[model samples]
Target chain A: MRGEAPRGAPNRLDLHDLSLFAGWDPGGRWRLFGEFELGEALVVREGRLRTDQREFDYERLYAEYDLRPDLKLRLGKFLTPVGRWNLIHADPLVWTTRRPLTTELPFAAHASGLSLLGEGAWHGGVFDYQLFVDDSLALDPDRGDRPLAGGAGMGLHDSFDHALGGRLHLLSADARDGLGASLAWFRRRGEAADRLLLGGDWHRRRGRLVLDSEAFYRFGRSADDWGGFLQAVARIHGGLHLVGRYEYIRSADLGAEGGAGLLGLTWRFHRAGVVKLGFQESAGPRVQPDGWILSYGLLY
Target chain B: MARGAYRSQVGLWSWPILAVLLMGISGGALAAAPGIAVVVHDPALAAGLDRASLARIYRRWQRIDTAGRPLVPVNLPADAPLRRAFTQALFRQSPEDMRGFWDERYFQGVSPPTVLASPEAVERFVRRTPGALGYLPDCRTPPDLVVALRLRWPRAAGIDPFGLCQEGD
Candidate 1:
């Protein structure tokens, strides 16, 4: 439900996503979860579909075993242990349909490997932690941002270059309030380039108000880039909410600086459906064409 | 002229009659609202829990207790009216909002609590399991059931439309 400038050529509706989420739990010893999406894009040249392309993507397909109530072992492809947005970016979960580039502009978002996830009580709160190591192929970062599933998202990896990462989360005892930090290191084949990233996130929800934000910085041999977003949502009434978001990015590598302020209102009038309208204004040199979105989305 | 006067009299009296009928329906609904009780297998494990702890337990966001015991929260069937009342009283969330929350959590490799066949089944499960916690529609208090908390109906119903259930209350 996002339209760009001049003619709204690359309008978001040019693509469609048919998605499914399923899970099975057997007596608490083991659990299974899968999220799949089939995307069809117009493959347009001007305003017409020159050809159509189809892709089936498995965003998450993993089996987890609870070795302990506070800890679990999971094997398969999962969202990288990075930031809040990556884990909860699905259309039905996020506050806005428009995504911030900071979340996806660098590094592939998926990791295929074994992960150790654990949580325990701490003081007046709890701290959750995850460590991941993967040597799997990733869809290029830019492609993963679009709705078009870039490749057969379900796969095995033959290339043996490994990256290790982890995230630590400390939250209030209730788990509604928290802070998180993440870091990852990856040096591609023969030390051709070294890439490292650091990120932090915070979220708090009280009564009718919710606030969450995340920041990410990538350090490279030659150029450094950083980006972040801050957002809040206030529930005004039953199933009605007002939301505001600010997104910023500075890329020395791409020599680009940009930001956008977005405000939206949503009416969750239906059980699983919402109608949302949002307006965004761009800032900086890139002149991100100001736009508005009116759309309906559902979880089911 | 007498027939016209009689029709006017019926119209004038019908408003109060309808009001009385509506009051009856509402009163019946309120009286029928199911009372809810937090039940645990062991009475000793009930301490350190309040509304916040209750919400997290049912949400499956927190799966352990204060003393680090693995807590397994059971629930009644999804469509049970009593279950709706319990969810409303605790989470202040509609059934659909909950389904969506569970779906999102599933993709995160987190599973929701188990749904037992009936509230009686939930009561029985909590009795059999060491670290089990659950809710029942009434405070009947089965032979082995321990009621950690109980809420009178109507007032305890999702009366607080916002998500935060009064924590200590």
Candidate 2:
């Protein structure tokens, strides 16, 4: 369920979505994965059901082959690894219902391409890297989806055929701490500005506390935008956590600056089930409504 | 003569009883401080492996072995005490604490270590499957299986987690 209430507006609630994930490794070296979601599966506003909101969305569909035990070749459409959150953005895996705009806004969040991915040990740490190229010929394009702040914003709707990107992450020996960097270049369908994006992310876990942050800067003839968010989660006890975040984005297209502060609690009652309740307040420009939000996500 | 014969008979009877008591005491001491042994099929593959490397292999982060072959790590049942001890000693984490990590890896098309029904099953699998790795109660570790790292967990913390122990011999 999702709830949003604009200033002086009545609060609205709706059944948010249902997602399906399938992964298959049928012996040998070939593998397949897919994730599909039924968005706005049901909606109720002013105590009445709305049927027009339901639609099917394909989030990821890809095929991978083992080039070696340490390397892989992936082909098809998959989540763009801009930072960290985009790769694991499923509601059940994240702590908050409101995604930080920095993660999604500056670039497209998903792309179709072939990628070379691998990881290895380095100086007692582990590093994984990926290099990918996406062309105009996409496997299955969701034109309705647009590039926004990793998760917030109303920015680009034009599709890009020539896109190239790479990401690298280094994790501590314990795998509890990591730092990541991402770079991408692309051209919009009708625009001449060649878009270039540079982003970085950090994650650290100390005892029961975790800290995550990501920032991005985008520059091109068509876009000049920068944004980021800092989030922290403290484990209150078993399966219960207190989450807090501050996010800000400056979109040249909107000609306005937007920022939001959120405080919430997440209860992971089961290993694959999570419930989040948060209250958010916005200052400057409004990217999203300021109100109470609740969502429940499950992975079956 | 009769007294001497009787004494000889009592002495003979007491020797076996004393031997049995001694054996019981030693066995009890061994049982009191059992450790977990990280085992592999080949001794060469056992080198350079410590608690951290074991943790990485089990986490699926280090997928390949020294020879560039995929490593197959196995685990006992989740509820097994040895499994708990192994994870705690190596990862400083509980199986419950790894749920989020596994969930993310699941989406990445990575799988958790294969779980066997028991330590005996783990031992069998490790011995039969090349590049297989597993852990067992030190006392249960077979001599033919190469012991890579010995972890004396919470129950046996008095002993060193990395030091050689007799059970793995």
Candidate 3:
């Protein structure tokens, strides 16, 4: 569960975030994966907690059939396979208490679409790719989609009339070191405007140290904006990790600018469970909220 | 008042204890290795494999072998000591680290290799299944199994394979 309030406000502790995930890949030809999330704050007024802000979200519902080890086709609503963060943005997988702001713009995290994901291996490592297409089916947030994905400027599925996106990711076959680049485009759903996004991400892990970063450039009808985050996690002892992240964003549409430097410590009880506390220092031309946040995330 | 003091002490000590336990579990303290032999069914693919070959094959990175046959890498259960040694020596990952590896791989629509219940099962499966490969403790190599590579362990004779197979042994 997670929640945030300013340093000295009528700080109220309310139920914040919870999720359930189930996946099966029984060493067979078929696989099933899904995620159910309940988020409270993002849907309501920034400071005021309301029941209307409470939302149930279906982040993913997909089934895949394997053509080979390297190739598979997926059907249903899946996380956009764009940058590294969005796909692994579930609470349990992230290192910081608050999400980096760059993940919020351009498109919703959920895309009801189809994807062709495959990989090629060489002496160096494995190179993987994903191709995806989603239609302009303006989904209602109250109807189990992203309730707060519209905070940036548009609804979760309102980006374009239709969309086409793909990613090329390469990592050590062992998954220790990697990098990726993605490109996407879609015309405005009901306007002459259009939006295209170009993104790049990279990560490397050696022994007790891990480093990762992702950046995106937006080409929109009104303004060209950009943002990214660089983060590091160092294992201090056992399951304990010390984490640091620097986030920067320039949102031309929302007029929100600037960045934050965050330092955190986490105790991972499992690969999918962690307790994290972090402090953020806001800076730059424009300012984002600054506060200390505590979060506990679990996956069962 | 006494009970409150004890409760506070428990709370203070619990996390450090858990941390120590996790470190012990993640770090394999077995006899480094237990003399594991890389075994395969196909005669043509029975050559001694290098560290990269083991990494590529077990990771399912390069699926086809030298003979142009599709390769299937089999494993004894996740708790097998040989697996711990292999991961540490070859893949340079602790068992805890491998868990993170698989979780990340699932994000890419990839699954870890198949795990059999026993080393005997792995040996039999590799023997009968074409292009199948596995490893076993050196003491029990069945005649049908072709030794692709032999890996040595420190004090190999003193460490029991079953001891390595036991969880956190």
* Per-candidate iRMSD: 5.4, 3.4, 5.6
Q: What ordering of candidates by TM-score runs from best to worst?
A: 2, 3, 1
lDDT (10s digit) by residue, model 3, range A1-300: 764554654444555776666787554556788777676644233465577667676667888766654576888778777888888776677788777767656555666668887766555566779899876364323333222342423333333456789999987755688899999886534446668899999999988899999899988767788999999999999889999999888877556678879899989977768899888887642223567777787754
Sorted into a CAPRI-style docking class, model 2 comes out as acceptable
**Chain B TM (all candidates):** 0.69, 0.72, 0.68
Error of 1 at A25 (Å): 2.4
- Over B1-169, each residue of candidate 3 has an lDDT whose tens digit, in order, gives 9999999999999989999888787665443434778888887786646656677678765456654456789876666667766665556565666886666555544567789987878877997888788887766666767888877653323335556445333
Clash-forming residue pairs, model 3: none
Winner by TM-score: 2
Q: What does candidate 2's lDDT look like per residue over A1-300, in tens digits? A: 677665666667777777777888664467788888787777877777897978776677889877765677889878787799988887888999887777755666777878888877766677889888887435545543444422234555435556899999998765689999999998654445778989999999889899999998889675588888999999999999999999988877557687889999999999878899999897744556677888888876
> Candidate 1 or 3, higher TM-score?
3
lDDT per residue, candidate 2, B2-88, as tens digits? 999999999999999999999999988766666788999767678867655676688776666655666789988776777777877
Poorest 10 consecutive residues of model 1 chain A by lDDT?
A: A151-160
lDDT of 1 by residue, A1-300 (tens): 223332243544434456787877654456788888776544433466633565677877788766654577888877878887888777667777566666665555777778998876567566789999876635233222332122132221212145788999887754468799999886433334667989999998877888989999989788887889899999999989999999898865446788878899977786557777888877732323357766666675
* Candidates in descending lDDT order: 2, 3, 1
User: What is model 1's C-alpha RMSD?
Assistant: 12.3
C-alpha lDDT values of all predictions: 0.69, 0.77, 0.71
Per-prediction DockQ? 0.10, 0.24, 0.07
Model 3 bad stretches (over 4 Å)? A7-14, A24-28, A41-53, A136-161, A188-192, A283-288, B1-74, B77-79, B88-90, B105-118, B124-133, B137-139, B145-169
